[model samples]
Each structure stands twice: as structure tokens, then as C-alpha cells.
Target chain A: MASMIVTDPSSAAAAVHRLPFARFSNGLISLGRFVGPLHVCSPTTTLPRTLSLRSPRSSRFITASMATEPSAKVIDGKAVAKQIREEIGADVSKLKEAIGVVPGLAVILVGDRKDSATYVRNKKKACESVGINSFEVHLPDDAPEEEVLKFISDFNADPTVHGILVQLPLPSHMNEQNILNAVTIEKDVDGFHPLNIGRLAMRGREPLFVPCTPKGCIELLHRYGVDIKGKRAVVIGRSNIVGMPAALLLQREDATVTIVHSRTKNPEEITRQADIIISAVGQPNMVRGNWIKPGAVIIDVGINPVEDASSPRGYRLVGDVCYEEACEIAAAVTPVPGGVGPMTIAMLLSNTLSSAKRAYNIK
Target chain B: MASMIVTDPSSAAAAVHRLPFARFSNGLISLGRFVGPLHVCSPTTTLPRTLSLRSPRSSRFITASMATEPSAKVIDGKAVAKQIREEIGADVSKLKEAIGVVPGLAVILVGDRKDSATYVRNKKKACESVGINSFEVHLPDDAPEEEVLKFISDFNADPTVHGILVQLPLPSHMNEQNILNAVTIEKDVDGFHPLNIGRLAMRGREPLFVPCTPKGCIELLHRYGVDIKGKRAVVIGRSNIVGMPAALLLQREDATVTIVHSRTKNPEEITRQADIIISAVGQPNMVRGNWIKPGAVIIDVGINPVEDASSPRGYRLVGDVCYEEACEIAAAVTPVPGGVGPMTIAMLLSNTLSSAKRAYNIK
Candidate 1:
């Protein structure tokens, strides 16, 4: 993956001139033309044209002049997510002002998985940041199935709680299906509820809420003006959370999606054909630089820990793809820690808000 | 597609000897040795293979050599479904004998689509055959929303109606989602109900009633000893009825499944890589011989109409894949009208029977 960065002023101007306009909103096209520097336009003449929805946007984006700054361009995921959160906050305030009610999310955490606990805490904080109410329920590691069902029953009965999230990987002894089924369909904020999954798979039908992480990945591409319609998208890994549903969502967006998993032989051959690659395999650096096609938009979903001598924790967070190599090849790449991770909690808050609006007939 | 009949017994025997025996069941291996004439070994050599559980008593089967005499080796779905109905009738009788309760199915038809009406009538006949009561609700094409919801509410409240199926493709004026959502998940035997779809998509989760048609396709392959695990499967079309959910189900079986749809360019190149091809595209003869790999098992789901002057209906049923060409290049193929079509109705009856047993708490 060899990435070209245009840091020169002259190249930016040329890049701005080459941008195709139709796929972009009127405001974005004007913004690029007005704000682009001249040096960045140097690479514009050399960039090849494409048959894509965002081709116009891409043309203006390619400046021949490489970025002089030697330091790696750190993707500011936290900042992007924060901006989205603030917008949502404003929307929440308006919704509340109009309806006299705020969105409420009820999270049920069974057992004591450290990761699950951390995720729940993050969700609650995110909810608070967006002016949504957060409700928490923690059960003992050895809690009876009936007791957990009782909690779901209570949540289902509570009119105030508009959405519910049951932290997954419950105790081995308890029936996870039974507990999950107990959550009312309207309040299933996590979107893991069967009804939601079913709706997602059906054509001419849409899920009330798409799962947060996958939705966030698409949102990132949409915001950055990546064209998906009719592009070949290769999704690596097929877990229920990220891969399978993500592929379905991509297909719905009119992208021809091919899912490759552990069973796939010569995955690289299949991946090389993709205009967009979303690798969610948790394996460290499973996707090499050569595996990616040039100018492809890469979204790395893997959050793995690699041994690091410099870090006190003895490891550092790394994605499924080798970031250093991928940076050079991909036109745009989402960094592991900052990219998809933060957007998930933000989307959860969005779902919670939407859930409340629907429940109370506020919208 | 060009199909060659196995007229040469010796050549057929040679092909049987070359099939991968390491993946075959012990019983099949033993059956292969005793080839007097018309043994199951011949077609088994060409058919797709998958790992499946079966009771020892299920070993009773006719050989492929017997397949030479069409009557001897055909898997009689109509007869089998009749036998199954008789068995269910006995169970229904026992429920009445012991508990004095009858199992019933309520079908709601919102429009006058000829196909939907035929299906509803067939289901009612099947219910009668199995000693289960049938409730039918017919609405005009311009029926109002309240009228449909009222019927759903009444059926949901009635304990007598154990299962419900709202025929699909409602009039354009009607809201399909709202009507389908009204069906109680417990009685959603059609398995289009969102909860069932969700369970089907989730890993390690089993749908209470797998969608009838796709389930029938899998069951046929399983009974015939087609290996699915780790096999490369290409499914054409991604409609909700068959392709999408079928791909999900195949993935659950550990097969690497790729879905090719209308948006898929160079479909032949992708499909040629499949060890098994399941084509549901209704376009007659869309799949050609070159598109299929040698010795791949082809499951043709499309029941298309082709001109046939001699036929009473002025046409004959065809499939997306050309039967003649596919049979010649592929190891085995399912005839369109006879293959998947009959199995679908059989699975419907199976679903209804299961629903009855569950409702009455009968084994």
C-alpha cells in the first residue's frame, strides 16, 4: 500500500481542478475548490480516471505533490466521533424540547467479563454525552436464569426505557437465547434482536437500527465521499456482529460484496479484486500491503494487541492489516484505534435517541 | 449446458470408483461394492457430498444402478410427504385421543395473486390430510389496514390457531411490513417472521423453522450424502425467499459461500470456482456449461416456463441453468420441476406438523 500525500500548495490547486462534481453535494464541491492549496494539485495530472460515483470527487482529491511532512498522518477518530456526538447532542436537545422526553438506554450485563464491563461503561458515558438516559443492570456470575429473565421482564414493562443492550458472552450455564428473546423488540438497541437481524436480511425492508459498528464504518466512508454503489467490496471474516451483516448492508448500498473467511483459499486473490476492503479478522496483520489494490479505501476492523517492548502494558494495539505498508497503497485508510472503535458507541447513542423518538411518537 | 446420460454402465462404474471416498460415509462405501445393477453408487459418485447425521435405520436406500429404472431410485417426495402426513395424522389423533384438542393453522391472504391462492389452497389441503384444522382469511385487493390488523389480532388471541402464514406480495396499497410484524412469533411457521430470520443469521443459533424452500434444498442434499462443509458454494441471486438466507445457512454449515447477484460482473468467473452451484435466478438458461466447474453439483431453484407446444399448458418448466448443458459438464443436477419444487411443499407440511406438535405439547 503506497499512499500519496499532497502537502505542497501548488499540487492542491491542480487536485481541486480535477475533482468530478456530480456525486458530491453542492456544498462539499464548493468547499474543496475554495479551500484547496495550489501545491497539492501537482499529482492531479498524473492520477488516472475511474468509472465511479465519486470519481469527480476523487479526481479533485489527487494532488501530485507528496506531503513533505515525514511524520505519519494520525487519523483523528476521537475528534470525528466527537463532532458527530455534538451534532447528535444538538438533535437530542431539539427532540427533547419538542417531545418533553429524552432517549433512555438500559444495558444488562450478565456475569463479569472485563471487556464487556468496559464496553458498558463506555456506552453509558456516550449516552450521557448525548443527553440520553443510561440504565445499568449487573447480575452475579452465578445468577439464575429466571432472575435475568425477571430483569428483562422489568425492562420490557418499563415505559421510560426505550432501548436495551444485553452484553454478550453470558455465563456458560445460562441460555443466552432465552435471555435475549426476553428483551422487547422495540427496546433492542444493540440491534442483535432476531427481529432486527431478520429485517436487515430482507429486501424492501430495513432494520429499525443497524448494528452500531458496521453502521459506523459505512458512515465513515459516506462522510469522506467514498463511492460504494456497484463497486466490488470484499469483506474478510463473517462473524454475526461485523462481517455478515456488514456485507448485507453493503449489498443494500448496491455494492457487489463477496465475503471471504477462514475457509477461503487464496483470500488475497479474491481481495485484490475489491475496490473496497473491510478486514475484520482479529488476526494481527493478516492482510498484507500487497493484498490491497491501489487506491482502494481500506477499513481495518481488527483491534489486536502486538507485543511492544516500549510500552508498559507489554503490548500495543494493532489492526488486522499492516498499517505502515497499507498507508502507502490505500487512497484513504481508517486507523485501528481511532477509526471504527469510537464510532460504535456514538451510533449506539444515536440508536437510543431514535428508539426514544419512535417510542414516544416524538418524531 | 449439455447433459450426457450415463448410458455406458462401465464408464459410470469408472466415475463411481474415482469419487473421493475418504469423505464418504461407511455405509455408502459398503454400498458401493455391491453393484449388481442400478445402484445408488453411480449418482452418489456425481452428487455433492456433505457431512450429516443420520440414524442407522436410514441406511435403507436404492442404488443408482436402480436409478436406471426411474421408479426404483427416485426419492419420492410426494410419497414421502404423504407418509409423513400419515404419521402426523396419527399424532394428531393421539392428541385428540388423550387431550381432546386439535392443532390448527390460520392463513391470511391479502391479495388475489394466483400463485399465493394456489399455495394457500395446497396448504389447507395438506392440513386436512394431516388431521389439522385450517382457518383461511381472504381480503380484497383494496382492503384497508385496520381490517387486516383486526384479523391478525383475532388470530393471535385464538389459541386454536397454532400457526399463521400471511401470503407475500400484498397489494401495493397495503403495508407488508406492518402486516408481517403482526404475526405472533410463536406461530410464525412461514419463518419470514423477523425473530426467526434473526436466529437464522446468528452463529450457534438455530431458527425454530428454517425457511421451507431452502431447508428442503439442504435436506435433499443431506439425505443424498452431498458434502457441504469446507466446499466452495456459489449461490446465484440474493432474494429473501431463497438465495440470501440459503447462503447464510450454507455458511453456518461451514461451507465457504459466495453470493452472485444481478450487480455481480463477470459472474461466470466467480461461479466457475464453486464446487456446488445453487441458482435461483428465474431467467431461463442464464447459467451455462462453461460457468460451472467439472463435477460440481447444481441445485436449480428457478421454476421457469419454456415453450413446449406438446405440453397441455403450452409450456414446460425450466430452470435458470440449462439442464442439458449443466448435466453434461457437472457431475450431477436436479431437474427443475421435479427437484426443488416438490420439496418446498413437503417442507411446508413438515413446518406445519412441527407447529402442531409444539402447540399441543405432543412428541
Candidate 2:
């Protein structure tokens, strides 16, 4: 996987490489509408604490879309993610050879949600691709809080474990914050801990790790050479995992950021002003063509499951954006399945590698 | 100090009352040009970390003005603060009689800077005005970092103490973050700890305490009935105690917030777009008339000193926003010395009272 610069089959590069999103389809697409987004955490999910993008019952805000058009350059997230993985693989090999330490990631998944299981499995595979060791602990939905805490404590104390992640949307019975707080800040590779977030929000301070998907969104922008500084950016949704963190990262990059959420009036008007728009709201086709300013860059973080009779799975993966309309209007836009999804896993791996390097004091 | 609603001599509620800012002339007027703003730190000033509204090596930004030219309604922070302090005092008295828990605030001063010392003195007097017990530990500039740590530990252990405030600019010799972090979160009335800030940033979560000055800025807005929801707010500075937290508080209040700092290009252009402005940059007269949107509500957090030969102190306090210009264009503007400064102490009292209530489990 030497710089798996995936050639977007649809792009000018026309590079033919199997997309990673297909392999992790259920996890990615199921995330947006899984009873609630709370069950599907981030690329490096902490306890799932009811991540919501309140789709109003009225459906008055959404309009029918005409999405067959395509004009914007696709910022293929799959290719970018693979390229990052290849770089990490090389670095991981070197770290292992030089320090006799392979980066190790520990994942704690509570409850037997099949989608979550798929995600955990994909994470393990991705870690192997980068030559990192993986540890997993699966707890029953009925598991007591103490059991989950004991595992977190063990991971924190384990020398081999460089990064710890608690798969989000724990059993409704479990206290999410309590379980997450148990993960020591040093091992909180997910970057969901409040202190890391606080640091992220403060000037002259840095978070140990940025939550994966949001970090991935910024990484995609950087890889594509989008100038964030002084650009007007709008972040749709306010989930701690993606929207809030994404906005913070944009602001840090000097983009004047505005968050458009459930409470926002005329979100379309506010969103139209953005040079860069990152929409994480799970509502499919919610952002109409008129909502986007021409030549704006779009990063679609939503991976909602939409029913499709034409698909064998009975549902297809779609993003918060009306992609066809966005592509025609936007200068560049990321594809939902091939876009932020792959970057999410890629960032999780990157964060794990970073944690390992720091723990070992290996430059 | 019974509900010291310092009658805004300018407002129709003009119940004539001597103003506190006039009493603290050197304190308010000279905040900006007091050689620099670093001399002032608050209950939760983490590090007086080179917090500068650059003097420009030339006082070119300052222009001779007759402050009498007023058009905007003064959001009397002094009156509001006094009013809040009065309520807190009443609460403190009730708690003392009901639970024998007189809210105790412990202030640790690490240096002998006259401005910082004066801030500490005012805090002490403010505590007495509110019937809260006050403890002070004044260490020399050369005192070891451990000395500050020892006092924090003592305060954390002291059952009588409900809050701990570390005066800012920690002598420039000690590690500010290190000392601030040593403060127990429960007693961290200053709310400078990373965890407290972390809690502040997360949704569905609240910090044990919010930083005093920033909290004061929000409180003043609320008291003045400036509806923050959906408003465009731009915070001028990114200092931990003021700018950063002020933005966070505004965002929590549902404002679409932007932060303009030294790195911000075209600051005036951004400032002009704001419906609500909170400037804490500590720059003297940096925000000009063109910078403000007409009819905007301005919260001037920056308290800077400018040369005034007419005054006994030879200088007077002004905010980051030019009062004269803002008053003409703004719907409302906070006066410098009488604005955010008084509110800072008021917030400190509120937090201390809250801590005492929490400690005693009294409603």
C-alpha cells in the first residue's frame, strides 16, 4: 500500500483500485440513521452519547433534488485515505524495526450491534494493513458498568496498548460519560475526552489527538490544497464527534466558521455564504443546489442509509449532500461513501500511530 | 452594597449614585496602556501568557477624543455587576444562616505587580461586600512554583473553602498551566483547569465552573437583554480567560460565533459583519467606526489605558472597542472601566457562592 493514491475511477486520474467503503458498507451507511446517530460513533468513537441531527418531523425544509449532474472535481476520500494508510504503513514498519515496538490499539465495544461489530472488524483490518497490533473486548448489552470500566483500566495500564477507543453508543443502560472518562487522557486516542477538546478550543494549546472524522475532513481539505484561512466556512450539525470539532479545526485554520443547526434560522442562507461547507447532518438530500454557493468546496460527513429497490442490500449509502447538485455548483465535493468514510478509518489509524510514537518517545 | 444597581447616570433609571469605576480610576482607565495588559489577570487567569494588544511602539492608534460624545445606550456593567453582587450576597447570607456555610474564596497571588495586587485587593473587598469569607496568600515574585501548589492543595483540602482563584501573570517565572492544573476541579472556582474548559466545549455537558471574566461578559449581555441566540458574534481576543471562553459561552447560547485574533486578516471587515461584538484584544482604540455594524450591540472586553494628561493617573481605561465610535454606531456599548472589569469580580462572587452551595448541598 505504498501511498495508495487511489485513482478515482470517475476522475481524470482514472486510477482503478477497489474502494474501501464497499468493504465497510454497513458500518458507514448505517451510521446516520441507526435508530439514532448516537449508536454509530466517530472514526475513533468514544462512548456514543446520542449524536443527533434532528430531522424535523415536518420535512418542510427538505426539497426534492435533481442529482444526475456532475461538474465539481471529486476530492476522492477513499484515495486520500489509502494514501495516508500507505504512509502510515511505511512509518509503522520503521518504528517496529527501530524500536522493536509495533503501535497497538485497544477497542472496547459494548452490546452486540452488528453494525458496530462490522466497524470494529474493519478497524482491526486497517490496523493490520498498517502493521499495528489490535486488541478487542466485546461486552454484552447487559454488562454492568463496572465490567466496562475494568477493561478500560486494564487497557490504560497495559504497556502494549498505545491507544484506547471505546466504540460509541454503548448499551442504553451504560453511562457513556463515565465509561469515556475512565479512558486516561494519554490513551484517549479518540480525542473525545473533554480536556483534549478544551485544548482544541484554546489558543496556544494543542489536543493530544483530534477526533478522527473531523480530523479527516480537515486532512482532505489540506490534501486538496483548499485555503481555509480567511475563507468563510459553515458546518452543518453540532455533534461533538464531527460538526463541533470540524468547526473548531476550521477556525484554528483561520476560517471564519458558522454552525448551522436545528435552531438556526434560514440555514440555507447562512450556508450559501461559505467558501467551504462541511455538512454532517444525516438528512439525505437536505442541502439543495441553491443552498451552496458556486465554487464552494463541500465535505459531506453524513453516511445515511437510503432505501433503494435497485440495490441487492435494499438500501444505498448516501451523504447529507445532494451530491449531483453540489457537484454542479461546488468547485469540489467529497463523495459520501468514498469520501469522509475512508478518511475516518484512516485518521483512527493515524491517531493510533501518533499515540504509539509518543508513548515510546520515538521520533 | 444591597443590589448595588449603580444607577446608570446616563440611563432613564438615573437614580443618582456614585460610580465604582470612578473610584477605581487608575484601575479602569489605565487597563490598556498600563505599559501592557499582562499586569491584569483574573480569578482564573491561567498564564498571563504574552497577552498583548500590541502598543505598536507608537501610540498611533490613540486619537484625542472628547468621551462626552455619546449616542449608544451604555450597558452599565458596573450597575449590572453590583446588582449581581447584591443578589449573591443575599444568597450567601441565607446559606450561612441555613447551613452555616459562608462561601469562602481563596486567592493566591504569586507576584507583587501593583495592578495584579490591586485586583486581588478588590476581590477581597468584593468578597466582604457579599458576606463571603476570603483567604489571601501573597507570595513574592521569586517564590517557587511549589509554593503556589502547596496553597492550592491546602485550599482544595480546606472544607471551609468553596473556591480558589490564582491571580494572573504568575511572576513570569512559574509554569502557569502546571500551577492552574494543580487546582482541584471542585474548588477551581477560577475555572482555568483544562477539564473545566473541556466540559465547557462539549454539548450535553457543563463545566464545574466557567472562567470569571468571560462569564462576566456573557452575564452583562444577559442582564442588558441582548438576545444572543442566532446572533453573529465576533470575539476579538483569544486569551484563555476572556476571548476564548467568551466565544464558547456565546456559542453555548446559540450564537453563530467567530473569533478574530491578531492572526486574523481583514479584522475590520469581519468586525463590520457582526450583529454582536465582544472585543477583548486589550488594544487601545483598535476597533474604529468602520469596524462596527450600525446598531450592533458591543461588549467591550478589552480594558486598555491611553494617555490622558487631564487625569490624576495621567491615563484612563478604554476597551478594545473605541467607545466614542461604537457609541455613535452601536445600539449599545459597554464602557471600559465600568464594563467588563466590574463584572469579572461579580462573576467571581457568583461562582464562589455556587461552589459553596454545591459543597453544602444547599439549594
- Among these predicted structures, which one has the highest TM-score? 2
Task: Tell me the tens digit of each residue's lDDT in model 1 across B1-363.
Answer: 011111111111111222222211111121222122111111212333221223112644322322121121223344444555676788778877888888888888876666567667877887887788899999998899889989998998898887787766578888877987898877777676666877888876778787776776676667655678768888877777677777878888867777877666667888998887888755556676778786677777765555556867555656667766665556557775577666665676677667767776666
Supply every candidate's count of residue pairs whose N, Cα or C atoms clash at under 3 angstroms. Answer: 46, 8
Q: Write the per-residue lDDT of candidate 2 for residues B1-363, one digit (tens) a residue.
A: 111222221111111111121211112332322434322221221111111111222312322223334456677888788888889988988887887778899988876676566667777999999999999999999999988899899999999999887876577779987987888899888787777888888888889899887888787777666678877888876667677788888889988787776555567877887888988655656677778776688888665555567878666665666677676677778887687767777887888899988887765
lDDT of 2: 0.71
Interface RMSD of 2: 1.8
TM-score of chain A of each: 0.80, 0.80
Interface RMSD, candidates in the order listed: 1.6, 1.8
Cα error, residue B31 of model 2, in Å, equals 15
TM-score of 1: 0.73
- The candidate maximizing DockQ is 1
Task: Give the whole-model CA lDDT for all candidates, comma-separated.
Answer: 0.66, 0.71
Show where candidate 1 strays beyond 4 Å: A1-76, A96-101, A106-121, A133-161, A166-182, A360-363, B1-121, B124-161, B166-179, B308-312, B360-363
For every candidate in turn, the CA RMSD to the true structure comes to 14.3, 13.3
